[model samples]
Target: MRSLLSKVAVGLVFVFGGGLWAASAVADDVAHKVVIQVSTDDERTQKIALNNAVNIQKSLGVDEVKIEIVAYGPGLGLMTTAGKQSQRVADLVLQDITFSACNNTIKKITKKKGAAPKLVEGVGIVDSGAVRIIELQQQGYAYIRP
Candidate 1:
């Protein structure tokens, strides 16, 4: 009788634990994630990157997808308040897309220009753009450069 009770308890634990694990896996599978890298200041490249993000969101549905754009070096210009694409950036931000600027780039630009460039409202600053991209990739986000 004791042996039978022990076996039953073990089975119950496995059943419950397996259910929890399966639920977690399904949750992760339902959301698609992508990280886009922008290292150039070229307007065309920035536009292409933004377009890619928009297309992904439209195809996957905003609630089912996560998109992040990482800007470093000269590409940080795209995230600046005074950037040529500031209006577009702001519009995208309203749609739940994330824009990240590199702190290292901001510091360098500040040192050279005597002031830090202001990022568009709602933009986040990461310690390093490349590092952030790598971390996101490690977390299962697809990487893109356009």
Candidate 2:
């Protein structure tokens, strides 16, 4: 049987080790690269997402941040020239953040709704946002949906 002092020492060691592990698990990154994914059809949600991305950059003090807003469905409106968020979207583009639309989604939208709006110059068209997300994950980028 161990003495009370030994048991207390072991408990403290366990607690401190667990705390260190937890801290290491979070990307409290001094300088790290991130690739966040954004896909939402709602305007309010899109605004919130944009805010979240900005907040993360500010909070983490990331050195190289590459946020990719992958728009699909009605979310494409957030990246279009005629869309209400054009000016605000431009703000992100200036920050080196990319805004891309799902080409597959555009095809479906055009086939079903008969109107295929084009994305702005700053906004690119990817084959599929889902595939992009998987590729990013495989590349070891932390996945955040805001």
Candidate 3:
């Protein structure tokens, strides 16, 4: 009886302790880099993407999150200083989230509008938004177009 009780106790401890370790292991998986592709000018989807990015940072903790909002084509407007989402997006920019404006789109807009498109302060300009998405994917950053 004594030996049987000791074995059961050991089994129970192993199972319970293993569960604890699994939970903490999940916590350790918080660090991840993700790139959000924005090519459409759809207002609804644009807002959803930004909200999701912010939610991701909040839920995972900002330090553990590397989010990039890549704007190209018509989506470039979302990153423009003239964007209607200016206030909310600017606030997120202050939170250190990555915002990249596509150089190609800027040039196109400049030609059409006869002026350079303005980007939010602190946003980086990249060669092509599509190219950047491929680049990030090559570097193992998950692509999410939320």
> Largest lDDT belongs to which candidate?
1
Q: Candidate 2 on 15-87: residue-level lDDT in tens? A: 9998997887564433344555656667788887788777777776545565666777667778877777788
What lDDT score belongs to each candidate, Candidate 1 first? 0.96, 0.74, 0.88
Residues 1-146 of candidate 1 have per-residue lDDT tens digits of 99999999999999999999998888676489999999999999999999999999999999899999999999999999889999999999999999999999999999999999999999999999999999999989999999
Supply the global lDDT for candidate 3.
0.88
In order of appearance, the predictions have TM-scores of 0.87, 0.69, 0.77
lDDT of 2: 0.74
Model with the higher TM-score, candidate 1 or 2 = 1
Could you tell me which residue pairs clash in candidate 2?
none
The reply for model 2, stretches above 4 Å from the true place, is: 1-31
| Backbone steric clashes in candidate 2, count | 0
